[model samples]
Target chain A: MSQQLAVGIDIGGTNTKFGIVDRRGNILCDGRMLTNKHEDVNCFLDELHQHMSVLIEQVGGSENIKGIGVGAPNGNFYNGNIEYAPNLRWKGVVPLASLLEKKFSLPTVLTNDANAAALGELIYGAARGMKDFIVITLGTGVGSGIVANGQLIYGHDGFAGELGHIIVIPGGRLHPGTGAHGSLEAYASATGVTNTAIEFLSTRPEVPSLMREHSKEEINSKLIYEAAMKGDPLAMEVYEYTGQILGAALANFVMFSSPEAIVLFGGLTQAGDVIMKPVREHMEKNLLPIFRNKVKLLFSELKESDAAILGASALAWEMKD
Target chain B: MSQQLAVGIDIGGTNTKFGIVDRRGNILCDGRMLTNKHEDVNCFLDELHQHMSVLIEQVGGSENIKGIGVGAPNGNFYNGNIEYAPNLRWKGVVPLASLLEKKFSLPTVLTNDANAAALGELIYGAARGMKDFIVITLGTGVGSGIVANGQLIYGHDGFAGELGHIIVIPGGRLHPGTGAHGSLEAYASATGVTNTAIEFLSTRPEVPSLMREHSKEEINSKLIYEAAMKGDPLAMEVYEYTGQILGAALANFVMFSSPEAIVLFGGLTQAGDVIMKPVREHMEKNLLPIFRNKVKLLFSELKESDAAILGASALAWEMKD
Candidate 1:
């Protein structure tokens, strides 16, 4: 009998990417659609159904698809739902997997985006042969997936690996989403870096730099990295401070998961060594003497566009058994 | 054929505890001997061997023992060795498992003390039915054992779960053993609390306290707990502050492990709600909204005297298969 295919869907705040993949981690066909999170969730599901219909027609109808796997913010593997996801303004529990299964008439699974990303990295990217490692995505918010002994830790309620929200500072700046102070997300996310940079600029107005060239609306992590690369002292400071916090957070992560390596992904990580250097330094300084030089920290080898699709696909692939 | 029993050993700074345990987590026999870490390791092993011989003789000899499992300071499961453990003056990697195996002709396994405690808890204590949880022992130093997906995470070299070393404060006070500043051990250990209390007392000499009744040399955690119970404001402050730091640290652990519960064991934890109340409050305050109230922090029910022995015996029981 011929092997069946699985559909992988990654629903982000801005876009929805989907792919038909096989058990071998091969993507056969893929497509994307704009995500209108502002609309009612039913409307979002309707839109998803339309996209699925088109993809089914494109791939010689739905009979070849064996199942569907979804990766979304606040997606719960245990419940097959998304619960009050911050990015999509999802309120309460949305029965996403059930809805998808009903629409497509296939076995379905759903999990938080970070877990999917870690699965992607494990099945097809830098962590291919590794059983233990943490995949951290530094984007709008810091997200993490922890794999220990080759399995994702979903905890009791499927709400594990919320690395971004861990307090990096006791009474430092407040995180917008959680209103908690000193969270890694409050310091390491794109918005986090912006907040830190804004605070730094406010305190050191004398350190004139390219950050002043852009309107507050135009300022983002990319421009900050570019400005720092151009030797802007203020920009350098921003990256340095951000890296320090990231490193400290990673150090704490090391204590718990003890992954062989930490793979970093997303927009902010592109600052490269500007961010990695400080992280490594702080991590080494904080590590127990035995583990000081044992662990490695690396940038994610997976591309952003491919990562979500691959991760989603990997989730489907992992469910084959 | 009758099922065989396994031997479990826990080596600490002062003593070595060992027991013969069955697969069902029942201890058949137990023994203890001085660690004598200052002497040649071979001599220490010889002493351990003698104790084991007596136990085996009582149990109808070595053939009935299937394996030996050891939990020690700096014990490494991956390499089956103990390396540069601060508690032991031993300077090199001691092939502990192999040495015991060679001596007694039994299969042997090894892991750090904290991991052993976690495995023990998983098999016989608070986390017996749970697949994921963190077991933290607050004694001379803070140590943790992480259980994710029903397995202990030894990390790259069995050096994982160094919860005591994670830096709580950036450039904070110096730690006694590592000399690193701001480490959890510097502020949360018994020695740490005493130091902090001393610092607090010197600044407020006029404050009448029960601690004044004991000589500085005799002042310990038990005395501090007694004073706090008598409404000593300084003692209360010390515990509150320690719990706050502990709670903050646990908040970080929750993000990484996503464990259902964090079980606290050992001397410092004896303070019960005096430590747990502040820990819960600070943890809730620091946690992200989604994670708030999701994780439970509880004290260990295992008696301190029995813990190390039980944990080590549990390791033997777990490895019997």
Candidate 2:
């Protein structure tokens, strides 16, 4: 029998990653292209189709391809559409799954990127053997995918698991994407860390730190992490505060999901104890007595590139069955 | 064929309500008894067993009893135990379901009151015909039950859906049950409303109103509602503030569960728009742009007693299937 393959695509604000994955969750061939989200979406889809064709040819032929699975910013599994994703500069709902299916003449499934990552973790990564857990991605923003009773929780409208937008600080700082004040995304994301560092620098200008060496335009979570490793007080404060907010949010999530473990993925999570320590502290402090010490928090074991593609492939694999 | 029946039992702080229901979600007969929580738990169980025996004999005898379902505080569905329920003064985990089964030689199931309530709503109440919704009970304390993907989201240990403990106000106030500071339960429960009213009265002693008549005794949420209905400004502020907190928490819930509707039950919810209006306004204001106007917030249509019994009965019906 010929080896069957599925095309997994992960769309982001700046780039789109596509891969041909097999039943074993291995990527056979992969490629990337600029999203250029500001342009017309039809043009973007056309570009994606061309790239996919080239990848298919490289991997042998379309005959091996069984289906397509996509993970995008505002993708909806039930509607098979991307509905006004802010990061993509898309307006209104676009029938993404149908368009892909029409182009490839194959089965296609779509879901929000966070849910895709969760499926990735479930099939090939940290949660491969776990039945219930929450996967949290802490990149430019905080996102989550929930698994309950061995299935992804896509509530009535297939738009569940927006953990980042939950309130962490009432009437505090404003979150970027949510247009809401005091959201968990405002305090826990990588961008949130930068904003916090800036605020901290503004308030405590007298403290000498490595952050002063970097230009304002170059200030990012990486530089802050480096400084914190060198014992920078302001950098340390940023991580502690960010972790506390994350921990508090996780405590609340425990109340709702009650997962055995909460898996952390994405860039900010790579900061290690600088972020995890405070999050655990606050979570333990805030959790109900019954739930305390019962939930575990862990870092994602999947590579970022493989995680997204694997997640999309998992969706395809699930659909195939 | 013998008619399929489900037994529902709701254990409250003051009373235990029991009912027999059919598969079509119709109640055949219902009864209630005062819960002597202050006495030994074994004695209480004996009394409960006797009452149930009498009712079962009067109705259709043991052969007609399909199954038994009990809803109580701190109940664990997975273990069929009631674990350290504060309201009931239970010292340790009690295998209530097993005990009931042994006594009656019938299949028995158990879950927390909140979870039962959510199941009730799904099977017979306002959320009938809906697969995704959250049921919240705003009584002496706030309790929540979550439904996702047409099933209760009992986490790894069967202890999920503790919505009231989610922190809505960090560093704001301490919660009585969890001892967590600034939890939604601290601001949204009936006790929370009374506490807010007391605080408001302390701040503005000059505002003479109907609340002055209750100066001799402790003020309950009922008195506050009555005062607000009589156009008292302080009482109105208390409701508005409580609703705002409730609304903010609900917004967070929307992000997580994405339920089609949130059904409010219990005594405080009876305040109607006095609580609902502010909750709706704050929820709308805080919702992400994509989720705005997509979810519904409504009061429970089932009578309090009926809901309690229906929820408990639904557990048995669900288990039998």
Candidate 3:
């Protein structure tokens, strides 16, 4: 009868973050470990369990925990499995939810990280009262979660809401990961921003830029943001170009479901007005007249690192007793 | 009491089709009138009333008719109004449902034509038992209805599922109606097919075939289909181009909602394999690995003329008694 808490786990390509969260969205305790270091999925689960156990004990042991929720790349909600995730070391389908269920003797739920983020927004973040909205995470790769009528769109196969991969520029830029051409992720994400900076520096060599000070390998979204902050024209144009594409893609999404707002999350949003102005301008320029000026484009209210774990945690609260 | 019937009306740019339909999808009687002949909406309603009255009486009067359902361009389901529809002569927001209810002394519902087609597909067409699917109307203009989790996605403003407007080839072609560039409608509709044929014929005059006989004005989707049927390589390439763009757009749609199937309806589908082969090939090619080959691309089973009325009629079945 003690206050129940939920264990939230986020299994990213490089890091696995775990947290003990109360119903009020507070992370009581948390920790992380390198995800790729464990070659065997079983070893990964064992390491995750060892890390989570200490947090569970701090919150007064397993009795206080309601269940576990996990968010990962290629995670399937319908079947609690991670299916052929390219980023992870596991080469094939891995029964992650059941493994955690058995290891902790608790109910477990799993969904793609984007879906978890959407749920987090619905329950605790900016989309709290809205019935229709989209959450786009502009991190190393772009990710999306679409919510309509207050429910997450898991699609028929639990793999809906992959806005990152939607082809924006028909034969424009090539996404190395998905082999997709002109995908939103190719130009809107952190990696995309870095690539845009490099492309601009090389293609427009006559245009002097602060970004040229860094080598191609040394340049990233953060460095570009820093340069842009210093009123660097070339670095500012990188965000302008990235935002233009992101805005166009967002316009296409708006026409699809007509969501009330689009919430942006992750690192690339750090560019602020430099990016958002173009995103808003181009998104409006591309939308059908009826949808223009209607959808609110907002940045995430949740903290950077805490959002993934919190979003993953939000899923645990939905687990049935 | 006698078996109940529903009155269905489809208001198109040129033609207005209306029918009295039974619960089992049988049309007892139907009629058509010119939609633009009467500029005033009231006059149009009066003319429609005079035509529909005979059909309603044939089905045993208003008492036996459960309700009236209407499908029109730019129709809003939540407000039961037709708002600024480019195709319709009724210029602004017309309270169509209330007007119909007032005139006929029966309950009435109104939705966009595409959404109505989706309902038609759900209740009486290829998507009868499917919980999630998309219905694309490839007519003079492209329109779409998206169904997810056994419900139509009405979005926040009841204007959801405008897949036709989603920019497939950004900055590629101009949609004269919506003024957006490279929209799916600008490339995949019947109009788009003709435009593609014109572009091809003019650009590749050297490698010619059967289509040169017709003037630019004479070129249409039907003419191109006939030419392609006669081994016209240039004409066949028109469908190939249209389908490729359509297939790519469908791929983006599949990623959005991950529907079980995509049901294509309208004039272009009459070409059968010529259009379908490329659509399927390109759609599968563009899809991410997980979604590839999983979604069934189907043609609408409903008869072209009857489908509009049938789809509109299906909405009446949901009316509150």
Instruction: Provide C-alpha RMSD values for all models, in order.
Output: 2.7, 2.2, 1.7
Candidate 3 deviant stretches above 4 angstroms: none
- Per-prediction DockQ comes to 0.64, 0.79, 0.80
Error of 2 at A275 (Å): 2.0
lDDT of 3 by residue, A173-207 (tens): 98887788888888987888888898999998887
How large is the interface RMSD of each prediction? 1.5, 1.1, 0.9
Candidate with maximal lDDT: 3
lDDT of 3 by residue, B37-131 (tens): 99899999999999988888887788898898998888899989997776667776899999999999989999988999899888889999998
Worst 10 residues of 2 chain B by lDDT: B83-92
Clashes of each: 0, 0, 0
Tens digits of per-residue lDDT, candidate 1, A1-321, equal 333677888887667888887667667777787765546777887877877788777777777777788888778899899887766766777999998888778778999888888888988888888878999988877788888887888877788888887777778887666767777888888888988788887798999888887777777787888898898999999988888888877887887768889999888878888888888998787776777787878888887767777787666656655
Of all native A–B interface contacts, model 1 reproduces a fraction of: 0.68
Which sections of candidate 1 miss by over 4 Å?
Answer: A1-4, A22-39, A206-208, B1-5, B22-39, B46-64, B102-106, B204-207, B318-321
Candidate 2 lDDT, A109-209, residue by residue in tens = 99988999999988888887887899998876677899998989888888888888887888889765556788888887778888888888878898777
CA shift of A243, model 3, Å: 0.8
Given candidate 1, what's the lDDT at residue A270? 82
